[model samples]
Target: MVWDDFAINNLAIYLLDKPNKDRKVALFVKGCDSRGVVRMLQDNQIKRENIYLIGIPCPGLKDPKTAARGYYKDAGSVPEAKKCEECRHPNPVLYDEILGTPVEEPQEKDRFAEVNELEKKSVDERYAYWTAQADKCLRCFACRNVCPACSCPDCMFDCTKPRWLDKEVSTEQNQFFHMIRVWHVADRCIECGECERVCPAGLPLMQLNRKLIKDINELFGPFEAGLDLEQRPPLTHYETGDPEELM
Candidate 1:
């Protein structure tokens, strides 16, 4: 079947021109979404003064449109979102309120297993595979838009001056957009698997994210990006005698 624009976790920002007293304004943040929200709270961009947080237990939510019958047939009963595969934190560590029953931390799947196998393959094989996927690019920015961490009003691709990409189908341009965008969000990415779901090209985008998540875990320690508002992200923190970052 062809990919409809809404087939994935296609983000649609419902705009309200005027405020509504009866309407509740809340972001349906997944566990990872809460983390970025906590991070912003830590940074003081948003005030907790006029907000209502509705937290849900996520064994993981999938794109019902794209999820194959056997893969993710039931809510919270699926193979797992790629982010959940390596998820170090599953439940809310901090919240004023929560919804649904309390969820236990999930037994993590081996997130790096695929990346390790890919690494075993020769560089040429990896390049060929990635190029084939990248060549199918339609420049859909749905991946970035659906991500909770990617709530940016403007993205680099939206810029025109000295345009970073050709805006045309080309292996080089597509690869550059994918690689650069990944790197840009690497430190901040919550491994939510939103990108892979939104990819019209069906690129295994989670692999790139999982690799970074694994490296961060190994280098900095088992870090959960936005678990605690009081604590600093491992990437932004430093400790002496850390040898991993040197490698």
Candidate 2:
């Protein structure tokens, strides 16, 4: 019942230290969280035998900040999280035990609708739009911290040997940080939108992530990361027949 009250996708599983190999664990998962677990298993970060997944069909989650502000007259009137509104997968793809009857997944609509609109703008317009968004960045790293895909033992942001990012926060530095961060996770992003929700400045981080997803789909032919545990990420595999756009 606790899991039913909140969208567990907002919780960052990687932040928890690795569990003992002999210890078994059980947790509730929504569709996206299930994908995160699959990704961890695929990366050899966790063993499938060490965990039990209890799946729940997520209707959506209320925006906690909005609810705190008294934006809704009652609990029933609370708005769904933006990511949930656009979510294509509401039922867990993989689960050891399902807790409810499977809800019908949303119809296949243009998930990249916002990204497509951004693409229609002139190059300069797009640049200006992103620059303004980047200007508000605090370099807080909340986005990176909340991401399940960012499981590096030592993150590049914290590296000092080559100093990937400068200590000062500026528009240029923020832009570079976001650009590189998105690229690093581009092939693995599950589109849970936790990064945007956790952001203090309210940057539309999903738009940047989805843009990369759109490009990857077009160039590599409709690849969705974290959907199938057996599938290799498009960027991780090389094919001779791959498009020459980057070449």
Candidate 3:
């Protein structure tokens, strides 16, 4: 079988499309890629029985862009990709077969350090911070294209029927888009960091994602999305004990 490096997001995506729906497929997955698979399965976008998974223990990848620019003279000196530095799962969570020795998971660090710091800011300060990020947006939609959770057949932003959003690229419009996008995947985000990595604006999209994730955990008990097959996202299901304010 032919094998080559492929973008994890691309492979994990398209599984939701009609072309792949009926086929029995085998997928090679890293930690992030495996999470995407779990996301699709939990969303009922793909059937687990039709697929085989080969897991790889990821040691994190070097930043190709920086390496190509000769940011480091030696391979060993190249820093790990920013996304991988914060990765909680270095070994695939679900796989039919695994290859290579399982790498030791990184020491648990506070994943929400940035989010917690931002929470200490006043409401106006938070708004100003987000506004600045929105102003830098090019509206290229690269983040959405690479997102595994955004597998809708017809995206609302692209619809012409109601003309929900215009082509205007103002800061206001950009903020609207970003907020809507984040909220849509807030509960289901796999923490793959593809959105921030692919963004041309270099926006800290993960901050927004993690902020929501933090809030969800606090409100509904500690939970991680796409990690368990049986546990549903807290936001997706209703519990009688859930906060009355939520209703």
Candidate 4:
């Protein structure tokens, strides 16, 4: 089935929330979206027997607005999201069938190079950088909606009981939103770079996601989620003699 944002927007909730079809059949899996699939399987949300994945090589999806460079030789489709630039795992790890040749791992995977330097700046400078970015945010959930990892039945923000964020987009609220989202999906985020693609605000969102990606590699002795369909994620798995990084 050819599913995109348009198809999803029209029928996703209906299909996902209530599936009347007899055959579960197959579905597409973007690397990050695979987190949702694994999680759904983990929670018995779906049966493995009736499901298969068709994976595509991710090219660091872009935020449509951020994609517009004034004068570029070959600036293809301009994605509106910013997360595409810093995406680390552009290749799919697991697939029944792949569409094209695998994307070569970059020699320099330091997608966080800019963010690291920004972190070294004075506290006020760092604050200024983020503030500028947050100011640009219209509080659109494009990042959250497009992300395959954000599969909460009801998101924390929608919780009027706690009211994590106000309707007004505050700096604290913006940071809070990103922080909660990353932690929620940290263990399962496959670094597919989808969340960064739909953002109208050109925030350096990948810095946060890449931090986890790099940390998982360094701390956990190289872990890649969604590579092996049979295997669950390492962070969710446990053994007696695990690496000392956790301690």
Better of 2 and 3 by lDDT: 3
Ranking the candidates on TM-score from highest down gives: 2, 3, 1, 4
Which pairs in model 3 have colliding backbones?
none
- What digit string (tens of lDDT, one per residue) describes model 2 on residues 94-181? 7889997888889897989899999999999999999999999999999888887776768889999999899999999999999889
lDDT of each: 0.62, 0.81, 0.83, 0.59
Backbone collision tally, model 2: 0
Cα shift from native, residue 122, model 1 (Å): 1.6
Evaluated at residue 30, the lDDT of candidate 4 is 51
Which runs of model 2 end up more than 4 angstroms from their true locations? 12-16, 19-22
Q: lDDT score, residue 137, model 3?
A: 94
Model 1 segments more than 4 A misplaced: 1-24, 39-45, 67-88, 234-247
Worst 10 residues of 1 by lDDT: 9-18
RMSD of each: 5.8, 1.9, 2.2, 5.1
Judge candidate 3 at residue 202 and give its lDDT: 93
> Distance (Å) between predicted and true CA of 57, model 1?
2.0
Each model's backbone clash number: 0, 0, 0, 10
Pairs with backbone N, CA or C atoms under 3 Å apart (clashes), candidate 4: 62-81, 63-79, 63-80, 63-81, 64-79, 64-80, 64-81, 65-80, 81-197, 83-196
TM-score of 3: 0.92
State which candidate has the highest lDDT: 3
Clashes of 3: 0
